[model samples]
Target: MRELKPWLDLIFKRPGRLVVGGFLILATLLSGIALLAVSGWFITETALVGLLLAAGVAATINLYVPGGAIRFFAVSRTVFRYLERVYNHDTVLRLLTDIRVALFRRLSQASRIRRGELSGAQWLSRLTSDVDALDTLYLRLIAPAALAGLVTLAVVVLAAVLFDVGTALLVGLLLVIALLIATVGVYLRTWRLSARQSDRQEDLRTAVIEHIEGFPELTAAGRTGKHAAWLMRQAHQVTSEQAKADTRVGWHLAGSHLLVNLSAVVALWAGFALFQAGTVSGPVLVLLPIALLGLAEVYAMLPDAFGKLGATLASASRLNRDCREDKQPGTPKAAGLPPETALLAENISVKHSGYAPLFTRFNLEIESGERVGILGHSGSGKSSLADVLAGLLRHAHGSLARTDCVYLTQKTVLFEDTLRANLLLGSPEASDTELWGILEQMELAERFATEPDQLDTWLGSAGSRLSGGEARRVALARVLLNPAPLVILDEPFTGLDAETRGRVSKRMETLLEGKTVISLAHGSEALPGTDRVIYLSG
Candidate 1:
């Protein structure tokens, strides 16, 4: 419950809107109850008058006022119901937007320590499914519970005023008991089952995603059928649990309905006895039973709302844990390097969790506009060094400083978007002419010239449509667009042919002449015009 405070505050940030929406929902429910009660009384009274006239007794009854009141209630119910839905939905959507933005910001700022504990699948779940679960918390749980409470109160008050204090107390007590049996009883019984269902659902999602992404590997190994069978088994488990939960909810809801119906009967018996004693009017006696029936709407929503409580609370707890700021006490903040310095490190040591230190007491320095190449064999901490310098990995003990740097790793990452959009990631405001100029420098202009869309052409996921060398060149083009003073390239020429590698190296020399560069590769010759070369040992 405490974990849900932030979300509650956000939902009610605009108190005026929340208040208006709540009022509309209350009005809608009250009007519905009034419409049923008034219509029942009107019909009963009109029939009694007809009987009197037939019996040769003079009687006067005005149908106009009752008819108009019924009409007003019917129309008001419809109008307010629509307004409530619209306003509440709009508010929930706005809250979702704010929640997503906050979650993304927290993820972006997550320390390296926190990131090490999260896998790609877990992050995706938090961003998509977990956020979606919270989205329903407001609409399904909060709003329904609140509206039902207000309606119950209104029903009790109407009973007391038109009848007696004893009648109001009786109705109120019965409603409270019914709500408890419907909500808290159902929640207690289904809590564990709901948690299991949610966990199984996430497991199924992860399994399916992995199966699809690793299809080629599974096929090559002749194990595709095996993986598919495993996924099917998980699906069956999810379905079984869901069916059980639904069965439990159905039985509980039926019980709740029976209790509400019994309450209506009790009201009817009380009304009839009062009328026989000449203590209540005939029309008012009919209204009592009808008003009690109107309470059915309020209790109907309780089973589903409280049944989902476990899953919603679990989601809230997960988000609260993952998105919290976890800075260690007494740790100094890392600051940006001075403008004149490309990079500086003194006795820096870095190690991954539960692993030996990759490098110990390492030292390096580079002035602005220096072109340095790092030569190291496989498993010689080349990539680790690059990550440390680029601030992707934090060091345990070090005095390290560097100006902002852009890193281009061995992998070429491209989204399913236009070439223009991919390039814009490096420089959001870059012009078409500037993009074309960079592409020409990478020798990719000739390839796009054959395409109708050119820079506007869509690149498949991860640049899958482009050849290996072409994709590398496009990645390089994006890196060139970055305005960072320093650039770090880690095995950037890994898969290119000799000729293409030479061509790219020469072009890089020209484009990166005025910027500080750190090229990590097997040999210094892989990077042309290198002013200095450093070697690393495992």
Candidate 2:
């Protein structure tokens, strides 16, 4: 319950809509009850043809009464439903976006202060599964179920007041008690299971991503079967956990149904007794049972909604804790010093937390308008060094400061969108002409031109549709588009052929003529045009 406060606040942020949505829900529930009341009249007055006809006429009230009030209620409910969906999805996405920005910002600050935290998988989990779990909030589980429960109570109270207040109160009390017992039971059973299930699912997703990303290495080592088996084991584990959690959900549903039915039966017996005592007529007695039965169906859905809301609350709690505990260091404010020209590392060093030293007392400086090649033996901290320069890794042994730098990783990342979409990212205002020139400069105009839709061609899933070299070119194009004063390339020429590599090197040199360029390379001669070479040894 404590965990849900912040998330609840977001949903209720717009008090006007919150109130409007509340009223709309009330109308929807009342309409449903009204519709049921008409059905009851038809059922109880079957022998009276005229009365049945009158009930049918009253049923049309949904269509004609209250000056399109019925239609207004229906439309308002739908509009609120749509608004709820849009607002919730957008809010969850925004929270995730903020989290990603915060995580990266923390990583950047850690690098500045020489602290490297949060693995790629951990960060990825936060972005994907963690954010996904919060979906329960907006998916109507919280609001709709809560509204259903409240509306059910109100209907029972109204029925009691209209009929015999005592019997009505009895039915209402039974419903509330039964609902409370079932909900509490479900919460106890589902809380840990749901939370663990979410965690396992995240683990499964992380494993799948890692296995797929490392496919090449696994294949090279002739361990395809091993990797496949490992992945299968993770998948099975996740499935087993999910199945257990799903079984609990089944139990919750079944239990809720049992309580709902039991309460309806109790209400029926009470109404029959009232009819015998002459406190209620046979028709009213019969009508009470029908309404009670209808309310039971609404009751059954309550516990599951509560359980789902519990899970969502748990997820929100995790996100909140992460946000508060993992404080990101502050960057320079907008009014701070002007962007610097050169990137400087004064005796910089980094050590992994609970791991051996990755680097110690290393010093390097990249001046403005210089293309520096970084050459190092494998495990000689080459990638880590690139990470440092790129503002991805934080080291503690010395100071590293940068101005106007964009880092490109060894592994290329592209969205499942168009070439232009991936290049422009969130920059919607970027002109097509400016974008095409970048692609052309990266020697990728032919690839886009040959495609069926040109820039509109979907580069499916992390740019899987693009070849290794093509993806790199697209990534480089993104870097070029940054227009930053410094660019750090981490093994950017990895899978490219000789000719393409030569052309890329020349093009990069020309494009970044006045910018500081840091290229980490396995072979120093790869970038012959580089002004300086720093060969590092582990």
Candidate 3:
């Protein structure tokens, strides 16, 4: 339950939406119950009136009243059902949007090391499967269960008034047990199976993804057949467990329906005594039992939802664990610096988890409008330093200050979107002309211009459509679009040939005319124009 508190709080933010959606659902259920109960009453009344007329006994009954009620309920049932479907589905989509946005925000706030525990397949599962389970919590579980209880109470009261308190109590007791079977009993019986379904599915997903990625290697080693068979077995296991869960839910549903029928049977049996004694009319006595039967539809919604309750709890628990905020204790934040300094670091110590300190008590200060280059080989922690400066690697024990900065990490990252859309991430308000200008400086304008869609061309997954150098240039152009005072480039010229790198590097000096820039690379030749160069020993 504690695992669901944060997500529940997020859900309750739209209280008005929840209330209106619940009202629509309740209205639909009531219309359905009324339609059946009134139809049953009308049939019994008409049959009695017909028998009286046939026996030559004078009888008077208004046909118009019951007929009109039956018509009204019938029409109301369809109309409310349609309206609830439209209104509730729209609410669900909005809730999905809210939940996805919140989850992304929390993931972003988490530390990079903690976030790294999630792999590509795991991230996909969390975002789609786990988040999906929680988004439908209101529509599927909470509203239906609450309304079932309310409608049950209403039916029990009807029984008490039309029959007797003793009859009503008997009926209510059976119905309560049935409700328990549908909700709490189902949850208790199936939670362990349902709760671990997510884990099973996640494992299968990881295995399938890894298998596909390593298929060529397996084929080369003449082991592809065996590996594929293992994946099939994993998939089969997941399906088998899911089938078991469904079977349990089905059994619970059947049991609950049996108890509901027993309640209706109890009411009909008790009402006969009342009918014989003239305590109630035949039509009215028939009404209580028929209405008790209507509750079967109400309780029908509970078992399936409660059977999946364990999976929902598991999902909530995973989300809570993954999205916990990363706290850096006793690490003082960098304060405002002197006007001349663009970046300041004092007694900075940097290291990754479970390793020796990469560097200790390192100090550096760069002034405004200066270009400084730091050269370090592959294993010299240059990228970690870059992350520390960018405030992405938060565990570093130091005081660091810098103006707003844009960083081009060593690893190029681009979404599967249009080239223009990817570039606009750096400056959302950038015009086409400004974007073209940046591309021309990177020497990629001519390359993309040859394509039919040019800037609109899709980059594919992680810029897979383009060559390595082209992708690197597109990423660099994005960072260059930002108007921040400080810029950090870690291996910015990667994947480009010597000629292209020199041309782009020479062009970048003009674009970076007045900004304070820090370029990190393995050698001086890989760096852009810099006033001073610093080197680190391995």
User: How many Å off is the CA of 407 in candidate 1?
Assistant: 2.2
Show model 1 residue runs off by greater than 4 Å.
Answer: 111-119, 219-222, 322-339
Candidate 3: lDDT over CA atoms? 0.89
Error of 3 at 194 (Å): 1.2
Task: For each candidate, give its TM-score against the true structure.
Answer: 0.91, 0.74, 0.96
Ranking by TM-score: 3, 1, 2
Order the numbered candidates by lDDT, best leading.
Answer: 3, 1, 2
Better of 1 and 2 by TM-score: 1
Whole-model lDDT per candidate? 0.82, 0.67, 0.89
lDDT of 3 by residue, 460-500 (tens): 99999999999999999999999988899999999999999
Model 2, backbone clash pairs (residues 3+ apart or across chains), number:
3
Worst 10 residues of 2 by lDDT: 329-338
Name the lDDT value of residue 101 in candidate 2. Answer: 63
Give the per-residue lDDT of model 1 (tens digit) for 83-174: 98999889778879988987877766666557658666777787788888887676777777888877778778887887787877887788
Location of the lowest summed lDDT over 10 successive residues in candidate 1: 325-334
Per-residue C-alpha lDDT of model 2 across residues 1-538, encoded as one tens digit per residue: 7776665565555566455555555565565555555456454555454565667854222323433543554566566656656665655566455445654554444443233244467567765666666544533455556676787677677667656677667777767766664567667777887777666666677777787888899899999898789879888887887677667767767766665566567667877777688887655666655666666555566566556555566666766655442244322112322254377776877665677887777777666777888888778888877776665656657776767577788778888988888888624566888788788887898778888998889999889998988898898888877877777888887778899888877776667777888888788655536888888876
Pick by TM-score: 2 or 3, better one: 3
